[model samples]
Target: MGTRGLVAAMALMLCFGVDRVVSDASDHRYKAGDPVPLYANKVGPFHNPSETYRYYDLPFCSPEHVKEKSEALGEVLNGDRLVDAPYKLDFRVDIDSKLVCKKKLTKEDVSQFRTAVTKDYYFQMYYDDLPIWGFIGKVDREGKTDPSEFKYFLFKHINFDVLYNNDRVIEINAYTDPNALVDITEDQDIEVEFFYSVKWKETTTPFEKRMEKYSQTSSLPHHLEIHWFSIINSCVTVLLLTGFLATILMRVLKNDFVKYTHDEESAEDQEETGWKYIHGDVFRFPTNKSLFAACIGSGTQLFALTVFIFILALVGVFYPYNRGALFTALVVIYALTSGIAGYVATNFYCQLEGTNWVRNLLLTGCLFCGPLFLNFCFLNTVAIVYSSTAALPFGTILVILLIWTLVTSPLLVLGGIAGKNSNVEFQAPCRTTKYPREIPPLPWYRGTIPQMAMAGFLPFSAIYIELYYIFASVWGHKIYTIYSILFIVFIILLIVTAFITIALTYFQLAAEDHQWWWRALLCGGSTGLFIYGYCWYYYYARSDMSGFMQTSFFFGYMACICYGFFLMLGTVGFRAALFFVRHIYRSIKCE
Candidate 1:
C-alpha cells in the first residue's frame, strides 16, 4: 500500500481500538459472587444545611473477614470503596417480593426469627451522586409491621439468594440490632451502614450488553479530530499572515530608510506622507493614559494567570473529572498574580507622566475584578433562590473575599509601589511638537470600527471551533479532558491576535492615522465581541438550557469572562503594535 493508504489504515485501526475499549469497559461482566464496592459521595444537601458535617466511610467488615470469606466461598465477596465518605441510605418498599429460594419457610422458622420491627418502611441510598430509596418491609393501615413474617422473608432472601439468568442483584446491609428493629425518621440522625454486592447470572441478554456498551461509549473523548483540524488550520493561517506582514514590513522599512537617508538634501522637497511623517506624534502619550495603564496592568495579570493555568492543566494537574480543581486553580493563581497587575499599571502610568499612583493602583485592582464580583453576586443570588448546587455558599463567598483582601490586595500594593519607584520616561524616536498633529478625516473603510471588525474576525475564526467544545464542557454534559489540544489552540490564538493586530496597525499608520494606540487595543480585543456573539448563537441555537436561573448564570459569568478576554487580547495587540511601530520608526532617519 501507498503511504496515504497506510496512514488511513492506521487511523481506522486507532478508531476501532478506541471503540473496542469503550465497549469492553461498558460490557464488563461480574460472576455470581463478585464484589461490588460502594463509594461515598457528598452528604445530603438538605440534611446538612450548615455544611459543617464531616462524614467518613463505614468500614463494616474487617480485612481478615473479607479475605477469609473470599477464599472459603471461592469468590470475591468484598472490595475497597473508591471514595471515602459516609452516605445516607433511605428505605422504601420492595413490593414485588417473589421469593427465589429453593424451599419455603415453616412456622417454626418464622417464630425463631420474630423480632421488633419499624412501623414505616423508608430508607435513602446515596452513591455516585445519585440517591435511591427502598423499603424494609410491608406496612399495614395502622402503620405497624408483622415482625415474624418480615424477619423470615429477610433471612430467606439473604441465605438462598439466587443469581437468575440475565439478572443481577444489589444487597445492602442496614445496620441494626438483631433483637430490635430500627425505626428511621427524616429528622432523626441515624447512621445506616450500607454495602453493595453484584451477582451476575450465567446467561447474558443482548439488550444488557448493548445498554452497557451505550453507557461506556457515551463518554468518548470529545471532538479530538475536529480540535486537531482547527488547531492546524489556525496555525497555518497565522503563519501565512505573519509571513506576509513580515515580508512587506521589512521591504517597506528598508526602502524608506534608504530613501530618507540618501535623499536627505531633497527630503524637504518630497512629500512627508505615510508613517514616515508621524514619528513625533506616534509615541506621544495617548488620551486617558491612566485608564490605558490600568487596562494593561489587569491584562498582564490575566495573561499570566491564563498561561499558568493552561500549563498546569497540560501537565495533568487539573483533569475534568476532578471537580472544582479548575476554578480553584484560577482563583488561587489570579490572587497570587495580583502583583503583575499592579506593576504593569503603575509602570505605564508613570511612563505617561501621571503622579496619581494611588488612583492607578486602585483602578488596576478593581477595574475588572470588581465588576466580575458584582455580577457573580447577582448570579449567585439567583442560584441561591433556586437552591441550585452551582451557587457558591455564603461561607465560600466569604473565603474568596478574604483571599482577595489579605493576599491579592497586599501584593497589588507592593507591586504598585515597586513599579512607581522603578518607573522611567517613555521612549520616542523624535520629539513631540508643542501642539498635536491634526488627524485628517478617515474614509469609511479606514475608520476604527471597520478596522476592528476586520482585525477581530480572523482571530475569532481561529478559535471558534475549540470555543464550541469549551462551551459544551462548561454548560452541557460534555467532559473536556483534552487540555493538551486546548493549550496548542491557545498559543495559536495569541499568534493570530498579534499578527493581525500588527497588520492592522501598519495599515492605519500607512493611511497617516497616528491615533493607533487605542485602535490597536480595540482591534485585537474585538475578538471578544465575536466570542460573545457565538455565545448568543450557542445559547439559542445549539443549547436547550432555559429558565431564568440558568440564563442569568450563563450570561452573567460569560460577560465577565469576555471582558477579561478583551483586556488581555487588547494588551497583546497594543504591545505588538507598539513594537512594530517603534521598529519601523527607529529604522528610518528621523531628524
Candidate 2:
C-alpha cells in the first residue's frame, strides 16, 4: 500500500467509534458530586424480651460509622483520644405510686409512656439512624406478670432528618443488622421502609478541573500515534528480513529459471520422469500444513470475536463501572465464542491436512470440553473460597454445558461439512527444481526465527515500565491519572504483533521454509507471556495483594488472560504475514 492509502485506511479505522460508555446517553453522567444515594428503614414499638429498650445509631459511635459519617457530612474528625457516652433513648413512663408488684402486664392502657425499654432486642432494628423497637406495656413494678403476658403498645420511633436532604436514595430493602434476620415473629407485625433524595458537595480537585477544562478529548490522535510508531517499527523489521530472504529466494529461483530455459532435450527428459508432470503436482510448497490451519483458524475466531465485541460496545451493551453486568456479559460471550474457536480450528485443520471426519469431531469435542472443565474447576474453587452460592449455580452450569454441547457442537459439525464440500487447494507463484540450488544456511544465532522472536523484547521493554505503573494503579492501590495510556498500550500491541509477524514471515519464506509460519506467529506473540511473567515477578517483588485475595486465583486468572493474549497475538501476526506472502506471490505471478 502507498503512503496515501495507508493514511486513508488509518483514517477509516479511526472513524470507527466503538466506545461503550459514550454510546449511551445515560453513561455521560459521571460528574463527581453526581447525586448517588443509599437508604434503609426500620419500624417498631419499644420493648423486647431480653432488654428494656432499643437504641439505634449506636454505630455512629463506632470507627467505621465515624468514617462513613465524615465522608457523608464532608468533615474530618481530628481527635486523637476521645470519649463520648452513647445516648440512651427511650419512651419514659412513670406509673402512680399504687402500682407495686402484683399485677400482670395486660393488653389495655394508654399510660404516660406506651413503649417500655427492653434489652432483648435493643440492637435488633435500625433504619439509617432510626432504631424502631418492639413495644409492650408492663404494669407490674416487681416483675410478677405471667412470663409471656404483655400488652401491645406504641412507642416513639427514631428518625433521621439530616443526610436525607442531600442524597438521592437508590435502593432500600432490609435493615442492616450485625446478626442475620432469620425469621420474624408471628404474633406481632413488623414492617420496614425507606425514602430517598438527591445530594451534592463541592469537593473537586485541581487536577479534575484541568481535565474538565483543557482540551477536546478524542481517541483518534492517540490511536494514530501508537499505530504509526508500531507500523514504522514493524516495517523496518520487515524490510530487513525481507531483504535477507529475497536474496535466498532469488538464488533458488535463478536456478529453476535457468534450468527451464535450457534446451528442449533436457526439458523433455526432465518432464518424462518429473513428478510435476506425471502426477499433475504443479503446486508444491514447503508449508507446514498444521501450522497454516492453526493460523487461519485462530484468525477467523479472532475476527469474529473482535467484530462482535466492537459492535456490542458500539451499541452500548458494555457501559463502564457496571462491574456485575460487564463481567456477566464477558463470561457469556466468552462461552459463546467457543463455537467459533472450535469450528474454525477443526474445519481449517481438516481442510489443510485432509484429516478424517471422525478425528475432526474428536478434536472439536476435546478442545471445547477441556476449556469448559478448567473454567468450571476455577469457578468451583471461587465458590468455595467466597462462600457464594450465586457463583453460576449448578442448574445454570448444566444449561451452559448443554448449550455448548448442542449449539457449538452443531456449528463445528456444520463447519466440517462446509470444509468437506469446499475445495482444498494450495498455490505458489513458481515451482523450482526437485533439488534446488544450495546456499549456505546461516548458523542458529543468525537465524530469522531468533531475530523475529527477539524483536518482542525491545517493544516489551518500552512498555514494561508503564505496565508496572498501570498494575500499581490497578492492584497496588495507587492513584492512576492517565487513561490515555490505554490507547497507547493498545496501539503498541497492534504494532508489535504486526512487526513480529511480517518480519518472521519474510525471513521464513526467504529461507524457503513456509512451514515455520505458525512458529513465527507463536514466537512473535509469545512476548506477552514474558510480559505477564515479568509483571508477576514485579508484583510479587513489590506489593502486598495477598491479604484480601487468594494468590492462587489471582495467578490462575492472570495465566488465563495472558494465554488468551498470546493466542490473539499469534492469530494476528499469522494472518498479516499470510496476507503479505499471498500478495507478494500473486504480484510475482502476474508479472
The predictions' CA RMSDs to the true structure, in order, are: 14.9, 17.8
Q: Write the per-residue lDDT of candidate 2 for residues 1-591, one digit (tens) a residue.
A: 001111111111111222221111133223334322221111112121101111222211222232221111000000001122122111111112121112222222122123222222122222222222332222322454763454333222222121212122111122222221211112333332212122222332332122221122222468446635654565456456545755765575455345444633354444422111211122233255544554445445544554555555455443322112233343345445555655566565654555565565455454324543584476455534543221333554565567556665566567656665555554445543465333336569546557645746645654665566545533432333344454455556666567656655555555544344556566656766776777578657865544222344345445544545566666777667666665555433221
CA lDDT scores, all candidates in order: 0.58, 0.40
| Cα lDDT for residue 544, candidate 2 | 51
Model 2 alpha-carbon miss at residue 145, Å: 58
Which candidate achieves the best TM-score against the true structure?
Answer: 1
Which residue runs of candidate 1 sit more than 4 Å off their true CA positions? 1-223, 265-271
Q: Give the C-alpha lDDT of model 1.
A: 0.58
lDDT of 1 by residue, 350-423 (tens): 98899898999999999887887677667656655754334454555676678788888999999999999984
